[model samples]
Target: MKLKNNVLVTADWLKSHLNEPFVKVVDATYFMPGTPRDALSEWKGKRIPSAEFFDYDTRICDKPSSLPHMLPSADTFSKEVGLLGIRNEDTVIVYDTAGIFSSPRVWWMFKVMGHENVFVLDGGLPAWEHANGEIDTSEPTRVEPTNYQATFDQTRVIDKSQLLEGINNGTVNVIDVRPNERFLGLVPEPREGVRSGHMPNAVNLPFAQLLEAGKFKSAETLKMLIESALSDSKRNVASCGSGVTACILAIAAEYASGDVVTVYDGSWTEWGSDHELPIVSGK
Candidate 1:
């Protein structure tokens, strides 16, 4: 499938192409700390016709780590995605209950795993519903498993060592995507005993600022928002409460500047928990 732009697609465009062959739709809805909705159960209950559930939390990550939803190994990623009936040549569209939150994480995962044909459904499920598009509560048609090759791009992801180096060397701009209170260390972290406050030398650009209602803002507006966060340095890395929403900021940064963005897979969940890492509070 030919995509107009690689990063995102509109609801109308996706609706028109729903029946196209080799097009796989993934329901990637995820909730935050206090939300009552269970993402997997909700996807099982109702989703777009022929859409499969991509459990963002389970599909990726170092399970041993206490941090939530970290990136998985390339081999693990390939196996899991292959089991979902995804092929290298397929045009994958990911959508979530929230317009532009969890879907981009899946989109980024595909990119990090070396699949370039994936995209996030702009405005997500709500946008589709608003357009009066058809939805199916029934289980989707399953295709035979296909071979998926993952060529992991290590540069697109940041680890603890790299994060520390970036901060000390001032080589990359670390942008925290948590809420102001969380970033400022004024509020207790949702995860138990994790230290509050932002990473040293990191700037705060809460993920919420990048969205309007249930959708992403205009490209120009997004660019401007990110521009204000940067000083003289050009390199950018994004982090959030966990690893999930950070991908949303990374997607926005990519759209805004067309620059390569890195995600701190462990993010605050790992950073805040470690007593050895330095932390600072307030603006």
Candidate 2:
């Protein structure tokens, strides 16, 4: 598919240009809490030809944090991505088994590193296979690592303290991207002893709403969703059960409102664990 300014690309678009040297496809499949499928095994078994595996959990994260999959340091990210043959100017297309789930994190990672040519494969691997696209079972040829320098933009990330300040000052809109049940504290949290409620003053906007059949909704729909949640406010912070799906909201906000957005790296996994922090249940 022809590359666009926003976050997604169709399987058909990818099929048409699989041979383009400048286009690099990455398989970024990941799962939550108790998911049984091994992402690495699945990627090795079947993947789009020439695609590389971008391990979301192990390769990218803040190792110092107790939280799972927090954003990694620029030096760490640069080294890891560089080993995968990713360069500064290459156009990247990231995808996962689920249409619009885990891949957005990789897309967000590239963006946070100040790379603008990245895009997520809409509907991901399932969408591509459903369209009768070719999938090679053989492993991809490994290439020499390139230099990948990550210039981390601190403005794109929000910590717990920053979120509290935003809530008190009304400077940023906090968006929760978990499912309605999880966000409202109606369902059991995957993390043991973690409460199910959301951060106080945060709006509920599940990440799924931003997608349709694996692809992102139009900019018009995204705009409406953001406006509905934030009203006149433009600045936003996104959070999820952990920190994965929150990036989906961040990408959508960028596409829809063009607002400066941040992702709470610890998210509810950290907040819900602490009883001292305020959490409100129900919409």
Top-lDDT structure, candidate number: 1
Worst 10 residues of 1 by lDDT: 58-67
lDDT tens digits, residues 67-186, model 1?
A: 677788888888888988889999999999988889988988888888888888889999999888888887656667878889998778889988898888879889899999899999
Model 2: lDDT equals: 0.85
In model 2, where do residues sit more than 4 Å from their true spots? 1-4
lDDT of 2 by residue, 1-283 (tens): 2355666778888898888877888999998768888998999999998889998687677777788888888899999889888888888999999888899889988888887788888789999999899999986677889999988887888888888877778787788988899988899898998988888788889888889977789989999887777645546788898888998888787778776568888899999998888899887
Q: Once model 2 is optimally superposed onto the true structure by TM-score, how far is the C-alpha of residue 121 displaced, in angstroms?
A: 0.8
With candidate 1 superimposed using the best TM-score fit, by how many Å does residue 267's alpha carbon deviate from the native? Answer: 0.5
- lDDT per model vs. reference: 0.85, 0.85
- True-vs-predicted CA distance for residue 196, candidate 2, Å: 2.3
Alpha-carbon shift of residue 200 in model 2 (angstroms):
1.4
